[model samples]
Target: MLAGAARPRMPASAARSRLVEPLSGETRLMLRAAQLYYRLNLTQDQVGERLGVSRFKVGRLLDRALRESAVRIEIVHPAARLVELEDELTDRFGLGGAVVVDVASTGSEQDDELLARERVAGAAAVHLASLQPTGAIGVSWGRTMLEVAAHLRPGWTAATEIVQLNGATSQSARPTRAHEIVERFGATSGAAIRLMAAPAIVGTPGLRDALEQDPSVGETLAAARAAQTAVFSMGVLGPESVHVASGYLGATDLAALGEAGAVGDILGRFVTRAGGIALPSLDRRTIGLPLEELRAKTLTVGVVAGAGRGPIALAALRVGCVRVLVTDEATASWVLDHA
Candidate 1:
């Protein structure tokens, strides 16, 4: 597991609730407390000093010669040997943390790229599952997040609140990929569901403002904005982007954005090389939390990988849109090259 730098993750909820169920309750409690304090890195106070016995015994256990040597430490090597890459990314960006995945072997360059995306997506899935996140989780829509949500297996993150950070778009008669991604997250985590029933980008700023004030949309937006942790990915400026394929944007719009020096996006809102919105007119009608709102979140994570994304990833890091990142070796190297 790659721990993000500096930012606090949810404490081990599973460990805290456990109890000694056997006759020697005192002995078991002391051992568990010692494990928490020494091996698991919980603070001494978190092991509970109240009443003295737990703390005193735990202190004694910590002083024992074994010092957790009895417990075997196993290093499970991943397909992508990337701890060094992950560490480099975090150190360079001053990120909360980073997860770097090794690509599955493939015969062709195209196949390698596809496998790399899958590997990074899988890593993101594992990291999110590790959070065992409680309370509200805000999510953004795009190919990258879709990849992460698709790879997520059934998990123990029970009864979480998952809200979409952006509105939905429909290309065909089927449900939008954005809705599908958020729904899968809720189902995998066994969380409560709240979906936004609006378009991602409206025709005009007036229409966008009106929809933002509509009670149903407004309430969902408020819940997402108030979320303690959020997971999103940037959409690069291109024809193959999820927005274009999902009918949220057209080629002309992309061309216009490129002409105006747009690089990428957090939700539907676009940013430039310097990372702030480059096109005020387009952003005025975009329906989602603004860049500043996302930047302020401590646990906001960006899960992205692959081509034509390095510039945007760098911009997102520089702008503080995401505190944590899950990526692959190639993309990580590319970002470092430009850094």
Candidate 2:
């Protein structure tokens, strides 16, 4: 019969297990054919030789066996477990994406935590490198972000520009190679670095506003505003946090912010429990991309890990601080469990 435009749909039974487990004696010729070929991984020639048939017939049997759904296949992947958490984060937080690294638990809890952090950093580095960045990438300075930069391999991105999202030229209480972090990012991505030459936090709002108008600072801010992707991390509120350790804040100041409901710091600004800046006065003195601006960027990636960061990480996610997240399994589980 010549083919026609309208053909009757094949019945479901035609493509079921009827070919292998035949319903009638007429279809039982290949009953054990798929078993001999697929189960034993036999070559078509070998299957044909054993069945006393030509290789061509053996191939036909295998094709019919597939159409009849005789053999079912499933693939298992090492990273399959991360997909569940990834989906939950996407559905729960409306995030662009999530990358969760599963690090094996070590005998020592303390050492395991550190090892997980390093693995997360390495994963973040790989993720960033995979971007093939072509334009301005705004990066803020922080402990986690610095580690990410350190682990980044060269040539992950090309013909790119690395913009400093916040002012970071000021002196820290302790020695911190903050600039080195941005430099490594540039070196790895083959991007040119645009340093923001100003204090991260100035003495007064008036002085901070004045510096914003400076030609160099204005250039850096413009680059940041035009950035296509921005990578940053949240800072925990504690004496040992980089912010406090670097003298961005004193112990007494942290106490005051906590008293005012500050849960953590992002981009040097304290975040309240309600997901707003904790203190307006402190924000005024902070020299960085405005919170609203940072949030509005298309690709704001928050790279963080560790149990202690869960509360702040959840706070940031709730407030639309970051669109993507890269962290270890423990941190992801913590955020999902606690958030």
Candidate 3:
């Protein structure tokens, strides 16, 4: 008989009651500790007395039960986030705040990618709405930003203004949806919308300056500069990048950027692995908020998701451009592990 399963004289029927193998002494102790500590809500000292062991041993047994899968704990919430990951991100990156969306894989890479973006966008929308800003909010245009705008509810915030942070005019046949994103944000928040009516990039630096001097564009840029909060998304350098698709960049331009060690882009400005600008001349022609200005904002919210975006996200955090971050669990973990 096992140490705890003492045997005594019993009826034949009682002896035959053993229908399954007995648990090992250690396994039995672990289960008992888990039951007493968790189910019974007993203190370690009390459990130790019942189990004839020290309180230290009881704690170890409880830990073992959790580690060996003898016990499981789940947070029963539909939109529960990983608070541990959020804490780790905020602490590790020196961020003001961090939100890690717990996204489950959908068994397909493409679908999973889309789901991750939607989850992050939803979280971003919630975070933004909670701020309840009554002033201008600088914003950028992208699919992720559009998703964020869609997630926002009407009357989410009142007396707010939306200022476009970057030029949205795309040279490609594909629309950038720049106007739509800010319009939706303004409509949802019941705020005034100021759109940047200019190309993201021009043929020359001189042309870019001329456009910036235009009254409407100049007013919008001034509004962006005065805004205390900025919300934006990032893009990884690839053929599928919106910059490439928008015709602001072509194959050779991307190749040159890659050669300069760019990992990704923020606010139409590309940066290297260490977050330094990859190409200054290209930045000179791009019309938007200067990258350095992002760090000066009272709040800068960065929303990014999907695989292969860790490098860029990490770069953004390191550069101090992202005071508040909203991303998927995988991306948050990758940033912490690599940071």
Pick by lDDT: which candidate is best?
3
Deviating ranges (above 4 Å) for candidate 1: 1-81, 171-175
Instruction: Give lDDT tens digits, candidate 3, residues 1-339.
Output: 347665657778765658654767988988888899999999999999999999999999988888988898988775555788888889888888999998899899999999999999999999888877668899999889999999999988764799999998875798899999999999987899999999787768888888888887999999999999999999999899998889888888889899999999999889998989998888888898998898899999999999989999999997889989999988988888888
lDDT score of residue 24 within candidate 3: 77
If scored against the real structure, what TM-score would every candidate get?
0.73, 0.75, 0.80
85-120 in candidate 1: lDDT tens per residue?
A: 778888998888898777766778777767777778
Ranking by TM-score: 3, 2, 1
Instruction: Tell me the spans in candidate 3 whose CA falls farther than 4 Å from its real position.
Output: 1-38, 42-81
lDDT of 2 by residue, 8-117 (tens): 88778777765776366424546566777877888988888988888998888778877887656654787777878888987889998888998887788787767877
Off by over 4 Å in 2: 1-78
When summed lDDT is taken over every stretch of 10 residues in candidate 3, the lowest stretch is 1-10
